[model samples]
Target: MKQHLKRTAEYRISNRRMSKSGIASLSHFLYIRQNSLFDIRCWTFDVRRSLISFSILPG
Candidate 1:
């Protein structure tokens, strides 16, 4: 009975640690995703601006 209780306590502790790390990793992924989206938006805007300038220029 005592061994079973000890094992149960250890399991709960490990579960909490695992969940905390999981949250941290999820937030990290979201941060990277947001940065990538921002970079894509900037790149697209630059491309559009260059295209417009090229069209405006005389041959």
Candidate 2:
């Protein structure tokens, strides 16, 4: 799964750009641990850098 996220992140980095990259760059911020939960704290930082706009997703 980590490999998958890395691949997806790599792909997003190459294909997606600022503002729209967030959706694709989800791989970079997503986390699924042994506790079985996805945590996304990078949203604030990413948004400030124009790397993504998670406003569309559930808040």
Candidate 3:
């Protein structure tokens, strides 16, 4: 009975570790995506500003 309990406890610990790792990976992916989205937003804003400036200037 004691050995069974020990094995169960070990399994639980390993399962928890695996879940934590999965969460870490998910958060890392989200971080990367957030940064890329920010970059895209900045790039678009710059393009819009340049377009406006070009329109205002004489051809």
Candidate 4:
């Protein structure tokens, strides 16, 4: 990955507490930069999974 991509990934990782939609947006932005190297839609899939899992688990 390029320096900018690495930086963006770092930023996205740092926003772990952000909303799923926000996370997807950031991931999509990074995906576009990667020239389709990363599948952001798939990333959002994982995010949705996490959301569902979180909703199922006890608080």
lDDT tens readout by residue for model 4, 24-43:
89999987889664577778
Report the Cα lDDT for candidate 4.
0.83
lDDT of each: 0.98, 0.60, 0.99, 0.83
RMSD of 3: 2.0
lDDT of 3 by residue, 3-59 (tens): 999999999999999999999999999999999999999999999999999999976
Worst 10 residues of 1 by lDDT: 50-59
Clashing pairs for model 3 are: none
Residue 57, candidate 1: Cα error in Å is 2.7
Clashes counted in candidate 3 amount to 0
Best candidate (score: TM-score): 1
- Point out the higher-scoring one by TM-score: 2 or 3: 3
Model 2 collision count: 0
Ordered by TM-score, highest first, the candidates read: 1, 3, 4, 2
Model 4's TM-score against the true structure: 0.35
Clashes of each: 0, 0, 0, 0
Q: lDDT by residue for model 2 over 1-59, one digit each (tens)?
A: 99999999988877766647776566555533422441344655566666434454545
Candidate 2 local accuracy as lDDT? 0.60
On TM-score, the stronger of 1 and 4 is 1
Cα lDDT of model 1 by residue, 1-59, tens digit = 99999999999999999999999999999999999999999999999999999999965
